[model samples]
Every structure is written in C-alpha cells, then in structure tokens.
Target: MPQCAIITCNNTHRRTKGGNVRYHRFPGDHNTRTRWLQVCGKTVPNCSTARVCSRHFSKECYERDVQHELLGLPSRCRLKKGAVPDTNLPLDFLKEEVLPGSAIDILLAVGLVPSQPVQKVSGGLPRE
Candidate 1:
C-alpha cells in the first residue's frame, strides 16, 4: 500500500495529520511517468508539489509531508495475518515483465538515448 500524509503544524512540533492521510495501491512501476502523475494529484495553480512516496503526495508545502516522512509508517506496522501472500519472491516478479532489449528500445524511442555505448573494458570485461 502506498501512503500519503498531509503536513500540519500544531502548538508544538509539526506532524502529519492523520485525517488528511490516504493510502493507495498501484499495479505498475512506481517511477513510471504515468504512475507519478496518477498518484500525485494535479498541482493547484501556482502551488508546489512533492511526492513522499510512489502514491503519497504532499502539495503546496513540504512541512506537512515531512512530519510523516520523518516519522514511521501508519499506526499498523506489519501486514495482518493472512492479509497477503507470504511468498519470499522479490517484488519485481509481480510487476509487468519487459524483455531486456525492449527496455533499450523504449529508452531510445522516447529520445532518452540517441545512441548506445560500447565500451572497451580492460582484461576481457573487468571483474565486478
């Protein structure tokens, strides 16, 4: 679950207002352009925007976001018993799969790359 928090300042130190916080679940890459825009609401005219996480966004100011960002997760920490699968598989396995070369093609098609580099490493591909 992706969480969102609205920053607020009370009499003392600022904090994330639980009332304004919300959670969302997405079915795609978090960093994808569409994903960010979908999660981060439209920016108010002349207002600033910042995303604390993939689905949580703090707009207009950073204080409110910081309150929760610096703190811990929402009240309930771990997932409830039997709430979700207990598989130990990496998270990536659930995301849409793309062929290795397709990524390069997509990157180039998007003008992110004009050309691919072929580097010459010492000693038959230097050891990592």
Candidate 2:
C-alpha cells in the first residue's frame, strides 16, 4: 500500500479507519509538479511516485459530475484538471527544497524530516 505523501497524513487504502479516501498522484509536468511541491511544503527526490490524499483538497477541486450521488450508489470522485491541493492543507506541512548550501541540501544530506508534524487529518482509506 502507498502512504499519503502529505507529511502529516497517515491515510492508506486499508478498509478500516474512516470509510473511503482518494489519493491523487503528483502531476507529471515539471511546472505543475513544482506547484504541487510548493503547496505541499515538501521536497521529494521523485515527484512521479508522490501522492496527495483527497482530504487535502477542497470541494471545488473535484469534478462537478462526481459531486452528486444517487441514493445507495457509491460516491465517485475526481479532481478537476489543473487542480492544486489547497483546502485543509498546511503551508508548513514540511520543509521545502531550495538552492544548494541552503537548509534544503543540509536536510537532504542529513536525511532529516521535520522534527514533529503540527497536525494530522484523519480520513478513510482509498477505494483503489
């Protein structure tokens, strides 16, 4: 199972916990991936494998068609194109990547993550 890329989130695809959660992968484009990195407040070596769970996004980020649900039908959710994680997201979720000789390199060299997370949001496991 893949863990959420958000520093404080522990959400997984497990059946228990809440109910159902969704995980969105990092954008493939360099510019968009950089935007996501800035929003996420984290520096990752590989962007392709990073994922952000749905709990971080606002209702507006999702597609309108997936917003409505029929009685007894399972909910369908998908983010809008070019959507950026914004709602319930932390600006200080983690340290950022910066130029060489900055804390970014030091932290990366030392392999140090943020000492303690300020907060953690709980959500259901992902359906997929």
Query: Number of the top candidate by lDDT?
Result: 2
Q: Tell me the tens digit of each residue's lDDT in model 1 across 24-71.
A: 232234344343343233432221233232112323212244445568
C-alpha local distance difference test of each model: 0.34, 0.71
Residue 5 lDDT in model 2? 68
Q: In model 2, where do residues sit more than 4 Å from their true spots?
A: 15-18, 66-73, 93-128
Rate residue 72 of model 2 by lDDT: 48
Model 1 vs. true fold: TM: 0.20
Off by over 4 Å in 1: 1-79, 85-91, 116-128
**What shift in Å separates residue 64 of candidate 2 from its native position after superposition?**
1.7
True lDDT of residue 24, candidate 1: 26
